[model samples]
Target: MIKRILLLITLILQFSFLHAGIVILNGLTHSYTVENGKVYKGKIAIENTGSQPQSIKLFLQDFSYTADGTTHYTALHSHKRSNGDWIKFNTNLVTLKGREKTEVFYEIAIPDHVKDPGSYWSVVIVEPVEDIKPSDNKPGVNITSVIRYAIQIITNYDTEKAKPDLKFESVKVEKEDGKRTARIAIANNGNLYCKPTASLEVYNRTTGAKVGTFSSLTMGLLPSTSKTFYIDISKVPPAQYKATIIATDEDENAFALNVELEVKND
Candidate 1:
């Protein structure tokens, strides 16, 4: 019983560390339906939930997820599929009073020469200008940390949605420091980018009964790219198990892959 309690606590801690930024009220509604060679207008709100005044910087970035599901952002114009050049915001910097909210309006100017007519995206990074290290102070004397929220601006210009083809190549179970995890190799063979949600169910080999389950958060993958979707299985008891992986694509298509996994406790 004590082991189970400790295991639950550890899982809670693991999830808490994944949180960044003060608050992002807009969840998946960041998507916008736009048209080519036209101007699309949209508004977003950013609030200062803290007790004091806060400074916010709004900018665009082209983002991608790594094999381990870590988000990496590049300058908006640096990427080949960037829509950064088309985005124009009311203000890049804003100061808000305590418990105050402000709305930022933006315009997307779709160029007539847009060759790729599928899905184009940019991350609206809402960064708090708090606790930033001084640039002129020195090299390695002080530490700095910045917490920010990434609001995805997914836009579709084509009449038809770009299809995403995802393939589950394999699952590898590895143990280190008594922690067990499953690394799922995912491949995107389509012409558009996609972020697929995944769930894993573990079944005991001996009794054929369900032992545990884990789910992975969504991560975007560009076309013709491969990434590893990592799932945590450290809380699972030491036993021989088989995992059933269920991945549902953009168009509600489901794919299943089964892999054998063995867990050894610390």
Candidate 2:
């Protein structure tokens, strides 16, 4: 329950730190599929809603996601997970006039020698140009903060080896928003993407008899990323019960998690 509360708080904090004026309308993630050797092109719109012009710079970076659900980014030319090399953009810098919008075009080139099929990605980071100026009547240091937003570009090769792989990291039962909910965190440590169909079957603890079932929200999980889904069990009886959550994907991969939850009358 405490963990659930913390998760809710963290989500609130993330939204509070969003950009004040600039907006990326295409969202933060883009997925693409390229054959053996093909060129995939796309564009995204960036709008400056503020009254003043803003200078922005765009670039790509390599990133890694851990089991803790945090993302760590490295240089564009990192040793592994470096998709920035395959990408070329039409523009690297742009100045958006007040109430102006512009489209940035990008292309992903797949080499002919690339045969291994898997998922690769890079983060398209949009940030303001940093400025440094000497303060006349100030101390030794002047620190200015720059806020950057990352848009993930995921590429997948069309091959059978790019399959969906999922594993359960943890299962949690919590009371959230006056409802009994089961939260399951799963990690996709594979080369593909998947949307798992999640369901829960509640059983009587003493007799082990099947009592009721519940269904949760399902979403797409990308490669090297983790997603936590929730199942609402508000209608279950107020008794000690055992619930088995069964999640299946279009690839026929199944994951089951057993958790104990006690429904309340309040």
Candidate 3:
């Protein structure tokens, strides 16, 4: 009887190893940005690179870091396992071919009541479940494999009440095809709606004479919300250029903000 039991155990381990094979090929969407009180569309794409067919499960969970730098994961979907904090949705399963790829899409909405502007990260995990047949005619084996991807979320607040206190938080300039392009972040701290309009003015810093002006279309800024604007500075010669951002509220109250940037010839 003891010999039979040992044989059964060995067979079970062997069968478990042979029955399931799973590998993760790719993960989609590394970063995402959404304005406060806006809806965001998120999707994850995964490919099965294993030899055997398998059923894959997906779930969303929150990862928290403690004061001592310890990390813990809490399930965000309530229907799978009852943990007090539930965000939404439940576990979903899909079958994949030996080398097939699939995509899963979900929507997330950020409430307008969010008070802070910052970054948030979340993970979407894909688990593969497989069944194994025992060689000794004992119970079958079940195997699970998982893959996870990190997502970054940025929230910007733009509302109607904050206009005059708008300021440029940061500006990044990059050259492509001999043209200078800039990505600018404008933040509003006052009360009122402000629309951003920018004009690139080149000046001889010491002479104070405007060399050229390149204006951009106006973009709306809700109170307390930060808006990102893109501008092209290639037209201005290789010199010091002052980007004048003019913000106008619904009532025609306007404010002028300026940032000095340099253009270098390639």
Candidate 4:
């Protein structure tokens, strides 16, 4: 004789959008440059694209990511820069009909006595509460998956005092399947968050003549956090070269590094 057990899996999806079912109509991120003791307001437009109605539950969670590609959603105020306590949502639960859309509102009240003028942030999670039934009557186990969305709310206080200090931690160049790439890791050692773009310039080691230049997409970097940037170098001919990589934010803050590379087709 044998026994059977059933299992259910729940996963919280991060980022701006989902493919089907509940969709975010407006956007996923709300960024604000705020002043002390001021109240700011915003809204998230959510829609049920599925034919069936959906019940959504909203709440706040602290957000953080690491260089190793680990993301965390912990209790409110879990981080030093978490502004969870400063936010108030209009409602926690909402019901939507098929093809129906609605707006969820919230307000952020900046504290007057906030001493540190940097970045404070949190996330509003919109989760669909669904009662799923097993598709087949099996003797084994069954699984059900639930998807959710995270809306990032970022507030920057005192831009002057919230400047980002970034540094390069590591760089590596690799060749695979006849393609070459450079991976660079960057860390923010400042008190604020910054969106930075990275560019790579290659020069001939023997002649110092510029060979090629490439840039990466912009990504948000938070204080005490780090991210990896990848640049394609497959077009560059196999040869010894010198490269300079620069990372610059929207505010014109730039950091650069120089390295030597020896490339080979094999």
Candidate that would win on TM-score: 4
Where does model 3 exceed 4 Å of error? 1-29, 65-70, 77-91, 132-266
Instruction: Give the alpha carbon lDDT tens digit for every residue of 1-266 in model 4.
Output: 12222221112232212334798887777899999999999999998987677899999999988766888999986888999899998999999988899998899999998889899999999999876665657587665466799988999999786789889888777877766887788899998889998889999998999998988788998888898888888888888889998999998989998988777766
Candidate 2: TM-score?
0.77
Worst 10 residues of 1 by lDDT: 16-25
How displaced is residue 243 in candidate 3, in Å? 39
| Candidate 1, 49-155: lDDT as tens digits | 76677788888888766455566788876656677788889999988877778888898898888766566778788888874444775557654466788877777
The TM-score of candidate 1 is 0.69
TM-score of each model, paired residue for residue: 0.69, 0.77, 0.39, 0.87
Q: How close to the true structure is residue 256 of candidate 2, measured as C-alpha lDDT?
A: 81
**Which candidate would rank higher by lDDT, 1 or 2?**
2
Overall local distance difference test of candidate 2 = 0.78
For model 3, how does the per-residue alpha-carbon lDDT over 97-163 read when each residue is reduced to its tens digit? Answer: 8777776666666666655333333445566765555566557764554444433222224433223
**C-alpha lDDT of residue 129 in model 3:** 66
Please count the clashing residue pairs in each candidate, in the order shown: 0, 0, 13, 0
Error of 4 at 249 (Å): 0.8
Clashing residue pairs in candidate 2, if any? Answer: none
